[model samples]
Each structure stands twice: as structure tokens, then as C-alpha cells.
Target: MKKNTIVTTDTIAAISTAQGEGAIGIVRLSGNKAYQIFREIFSPSKPIKKYQSHRLYQGSVMNGANTSSLDQVMIAFMKAGKTYTGEEMVEIYTHGGSNVINSVLQRVLKAGARLADRGEFTRRAFLNGKMDLLQAEAVLDLIRADTDAARVQAIKQISGVLSEFISSIKKKLVQVKTNIEVLIDFPEEEASPKQLFDLKFILQAAHDEVMHVLKSYDQAKIIREGVHVVLIGRPNAGKSSLFNAIVGENRAIVTPHPGTTRDYIEEAINYKGVKLVFTDTAGIRSSEEPIEKLGMEMTRSRVEKSDIVIIVTDPSAASRYDEELSIAKEHKDNVIIAINKVDIASKDQIEQAKNAFEDYSVFPVSAKTREGVESLVQGISGPSLAPSIENAPVINRYRHKQALEHIELSLNAAINLIDQQAFPEIVAEEVDSALAGLKELTGEVTSQDILDKIFAEFCIGK
Candidate 1:
């Protein structure tokens, strides 16, 4: 793979804080000329020949003409090799008005600092060996995390827990590859039974570890990216009422009329530290109206893409029981049957509804009264839908998961080759391939295009 070379010759500046009014905003600069640019634009309250590193000074940012002060600010100078990007850095803190922040940034730019690119600061940290690619991604995850579970996972990754694990796996693969190379070099020497057993044992251990990590990807994905749930049923089935009950707000319109919801209404909630996005789609029914037909089409598409499908039905809709059951059958793998309006339904009706959906997990709930709604919520947030793996590091990104899968495949090939007593050269090649995948996962070797794509997702000021 071709590695991208990083250059830190010019100073880069950007507004570090979020846009808009606040108590304070920061303008950050990093590179060889960071301090030089700072000196030109700032006039300290107390005149000093040399500035102290890592110390904040009261100063006023000078205007472009150097005729007057633009804003009163506190500036800090951090010497190279100890800052976030491992280069000389400067941060100017000013009053957080949009105009003031913009003026300060423009002054720094006029002093010979180029505007920083998206995630360029963090990318510099990665290239400077301050942190690995996994930690850099964790920084982004932590910034965007909306749930406590996601925040904890990002913290673990940023602390190097996942990097250490990947490194340990790579170390094992390298050792096994070294042993295989020795065998290949000395073809005249016959391999001992003990040596072959040891090789197979180590390879198997690595393969099993990869499998275990791969299993956590689903749970990690749910925590990082909120779950997608779609409520579906025939018209006048109380789907809208149940949606409001679950969201604890009147987000969806509810009327006695059928097909009230012509499109989907979505709302998100945090329950037990997991983000659940519930989409209330239009009711599914045979309709001659063009708009209703379009709404039904959108409902089918959402159901197909949802992580969980709640098939809502009530005793009042007993006549359409077959239609609801057919919909459930289509998504049997992730379908949950909810019997809504139990408060109004007679005991016999509730019992019959349960018996009809006996093959699946059924919850009898009164959306109007919120009776048994907690049980339904529990069922939706159950371990089957989102497993708890808090103690270990998880691979949340698709890139990481795909890389681990390739590593697993390569290790399996090596193990099979060993069992067949294949040539040492062939086994060594497989081991090398697996090691390369591990390297790619931690970014020891990666193409420039991949790096560009990963960093492009970040905001410009990041």
C-alpha cells in the first residue's frame, strides 16, 4: 500500500469552537509558523521580548492595518512536540459572537496562516504518532455520541484498549509467521510433531479471537447508530396511538378516520442508554387513492429496512386479522405482535388475539391508557435486539469489521494449510496476508484514498 506523506511546514488556522453566540470561542493554529503568525496579530497587554510556552497571556488581536485593536482576548502558546498535533500551536480565546470570531480568524489568516481542512488537526495527530487511526476515529465518535453507551465505547477506544488488543493479535501472527519462515529456509530438516502442533494451536487461538470480536459488531453498531424500528398495520389499527405512547408525546396525528397518516413520522427516544428511533409509517390497506397507494409503498420499504418491525393490531380490526398475519410472516425473523387497545377489548378478545399470534412474541397493550406498554418496551429493548457487551472493546465501523473478516479468512486458510501439511512457503504467505490486514486495521499501511474518505466526514473546524 502507498502511505501518504504529511507535511507540517505551513501554519494552519481555524475556528475551533462551534458557530454562533457563546461565552467564549477559540481560534486554533498549528504548524511551524503558528507562533510567528500569533506574534504578528496579537499585542500583549504586557510587553515581553519572548513568550512563555503553555501559558496564557492577556492581549488584543490587532487589526489588518495594525491601527487599532479588533478584540480583547487571551492567547496561549504551546511549544512543538507537546501539543495536540505535535507541532507548535496557538489558541486565541475571544468573546463568542459570530462577528468577533470571524474577525479574529480573518486576522490570523491575513498573518499568513492557511485555513485548515476538515479533520486536518486530528489527521496531523495520527501522522505525528500521537495516536493511532482507531483512537482518531474514537475522537470523532465521542464528539458525535448522543447516548451514554456510545460515549463509554468511544472512551475505551480512545484510551488505546482496542489498539492494544489489535497489537497483541498482530504480535501472535508475526511469531507464527517467523516460525513458518524458518521451516521454509531449512527444507532439509524434517518438521517435528510438537512444532506443527504449536503452530496450529497459535493460529487457532488467533482465529477464535477474531471470531469473538466479529460477534460484537452488531451490538456495537446498534449502540453507535440508533436502531431503526417501523410500526406497521392496517388502517384504524391504533398504530399512531401506540407510536405516541412509546414516544411519550403526541408526535403522530391520531384520528378516528382511516389512513390519517399518509406518510411516515419519525421520533427518537433514549431508553436504558440505547437510542431507539421509531418510525410511524402510513397504514397498510387496499386503497384506490393514488396518495394512499404511494403511502403503502413507502411503508413496505421502511419495514424491509427496519431493524425491528412491530405489527400493531387491535380487537376492533378483527376483520383484517389475516392481512396483519401475512405482514408478520414476511418479517418473521424480527417481527413482534402487539395487541393494542386491550383496555377496551373484552377478556375473551384479548385471549383470542394472543392465541392467534402464539407463534411470535406477543404483547397486549392499551395505547390510550399505556397499560402493558412497559412490557412492550422491554421486549423491544431485550438482549436479542441489543446485546450488552460493555466490558470489552467492539468494532463499530464497517471498515474495521470488513478488515477483521478478511483477517479471519486468511487465518482460516493458514490453519487448513497447516492441517494438510502443506509447503511452508504457502503457509507463510497466508500468515503474511493476515498480518497485512491487521496492519490496515490500525492504519500501519493504508492508501491515500481511504484516508481522504475517512477524514472527509468530519466538519471543517474539527
Candidate 2:
């Protein structure tokens, strides 16, 4: 949040690789003089005259002005029409080092091209109609995705699954809307109620599809953020150990002590290609520590809003009712029971803990022995994984959601007007609004300003 990434039109150039030494670093140029700059700085392995588009040229890049050799490198010359900026583009691959990459990039900039806007290469792709607004946003989401579930969802989105779904809906709505307008256009020649039933049928069909998709939205958002899961139980119930096991990191301080973790600790888990965040909250017990008291209050609130809650308890603790139990009941649908220290407890004791939380999927896990941990992870991550369908569409961005809702409202208005047998113009207006919403989603109705805003969020060297 402290860093401000910039985008501009002065013809950008930047080191397009991660910071640090690597096998190779790429210095990229995108703008009018991209090819010209390459020709000036890079001499191709097979030197002729003209530069070709999309061809990798093995060559030596030298600073003609400084009379210095840069590296035995590769040059990718992209012509204007097909390049990232709708201008010529070039990438110089050189030995990975701060001095070499920086020197090459500075030479490119000095020759002509400017520093790239944070994600300018991609921004130009968006500008050139290579991808939609949703897809562009998905690229960022995919880069930011920290879990398997999230990555899968973001991949689905970036791959155009969600866009295709929305497009299909839009197509159907357009047809329905067109039919209604036609009926209004030819009022005297219109079909009777029996035939009007056809229009109604179409409306119902479109609505059904839209709502069916909307049903998955809550889960999609949850997956994108990696479901917030809170652990609650009485003191010394192996909650911290279980938390460490799931995250594969000793995030919470574990001890024989009852109140080792007085606050929440979070870590990421890759469950079934889905990402989940395990939050080990404070132990629920009678405690005089003001901080512990505050932690309990926080844990209670976290339980309220969490996507999943794992109640870790022993038979003795599970048998008794407390603050955590009340929260577990309120969020019973999202709660899972973890009978901890099963290595020490009998089957009867584990069963008793399971019975106490009959509403949840209970598992007996011994953190020390790493038993039943996989099943618990599976339970949490299963719901978030990508659906088996090829090209699963995930609507993970707020912008996509907003556009969909707008489209929905417009379609609803059109549908209602059709039902009331209103004038065609009113219904047509609604259809136009719906079409506008769809256009906005795909960048067909966007401006350069919006494009700048979107690309500016990317890392400077991306």
C-alpha cells in the first residue's frame, strides 16, 4: 500500500524480471521505437536488414554509443500491429545481475522508450482488445492468489470461463429482449396469449440461468479470499498443535499451558488445490488477563463471520457448555469438530465429543501423531476447489459482480415490461441498458482513464 506504481505514454522500458541474480534477466521495450531501439542496441546473429515480428533472434546486445558489449543475448522483435502496445516491442535477455540489466534498460530508455507503466505490457493488451476488463482483473487476481482454491478460481476467471458464462446469458437476454420489442413493433400482427407464452418461457429460461450462476457467487468469493476459519475450544485442547499441523508452520506458540495462544494466529493451507486460512483463536476459559479477555471477545466475533469454524476439544471440555459452544451452535453449518489428543483418549471419549457437536463433520485427530489431518484439510478445502467442468468460470472480482448485477437489473426491467405487455420502446431501453452493462464488463464501453487506473495497480516491473 505504501508504494505507488505508475503508468504513462512516454514509451515505457523496464527490467521485466524479478529482482535478484538469476540465469537471465529481460529488459523489455514497448512503444513506437521498440524495434528501432532493438536494431540500434542489438545486432542479430544472422544480420540482414529488416526486423521481423514475434521472432526470437539470438544476438549480441551492445551500447552503440558507449561502444560496450552487453551480453550474448536473445532479441524478440514484435511488430506494431501484433505487439503488446499496438507499437513495436522488444525484449533483451541478458545475464541476470543488477548492473547488467539496469545498464541495458537504461540504454533502451536513453535510446528512445520510456519506463513501462506498472503493468503496461498487459495494459496495452487490454487496450488493444486482446482481453476483457474481467480477464484483465483476473490476471491481477491470479498473480495475487495465495491458495490453490484461489488460484484455480482466478485461473478459471482469467481463462475466460466466467466471461463466457456471462456472455451466454447476455446472448439469451438480447434475444428475449429483441423478441419483446418485435411484438411491440408489430402490435396488430401480434400472436395471442398462447404464443406470448413463448416470450414468457424465454424470460424464465434466462432468469433461471442467471440465478443458478448467482448461487455459486458466495462460494466463489469465499474461495478467492481463502475461507476464514477460526478454532475455538476450552484451554489445552491441542488447538495450537492442530493449527501448526494444518499450516505446516509453528505459527502459534504451543505449550502444555492452557492459555498459550491468547490471540488469533493465521496461516495458509493448501487443501485439495484449494487455499484455506487457519486462524487459531484464543482458548475459551475463565481468564483474568485483560488481553486474554479481549482475545476471547475477538475470537467470538471471528467465529460469527468466519466461513468455517473448527471446534477443537477433549471429552472433558466438550461435555461442558461455554461461550465457544454458543458460537458453534450459531454457526453450526460452517463448523467442524476436531477431537484433539485422540492418542490419549479412548474411542468412547472421541465419540462423546463427536456426539456433542452432531451438527458438524467431526474428526478425531492427534496433532503429535499427524492422524486425521488430511481429512480435516479435505473437508475445509473441498468446497473451494475448481469444479471438474472444463473451463470452470469463477466470478471473483467486484467489478465483474457489479456489472453482472447491473445487467441483471436491466434484464429484470425488460422482463417485467414484457410481462405487463408494455410498449416496445420502454423494453428496448432496458435491453440497451443491459447491453451497456455487458459492454462495460468486457471493456467495450470503457475509456482510456479506466484502463490507466486498472493497469496502474500492477508492480512497476511487471
Each candidate structure's TM-score, on Cα atoms with residue i matched to residue i, is: 0.92, 0.82
Question: Candidate 2: TM-score?
Answer: 0.82
> 127-164, model 1: which lDDT tens digit per residue?
77788888888889988888888888888899987788
- Worst 10 contiguous positions by lDDT, candidate 2: 1-10
Clash pairs, candidate 1, are none
Write candidate 2's Cα lDDT for 345-442 as tens digits.
87777777777667668888888888998888887777766644345565655666787787778767777876898776787788788788777877
Query: For every candidate structure, what is the RMSD over all alpha carbons to the true structure, in angstroms?
Result: 2.6, 4.9
For candidate 2, give the lDDT: 0.75
- Model 1 clashes, total count: 0
lDDT of each: 0.87, 0.75
In model 2, residue pairs whose N, Cα or C atoms come closer than 3 Å (at least 3 residues apart or on different chains), thus clashing, are: 11-114, 12-114, 12-115, 13-114, 13-115, 13-116, 149-274, 149-275
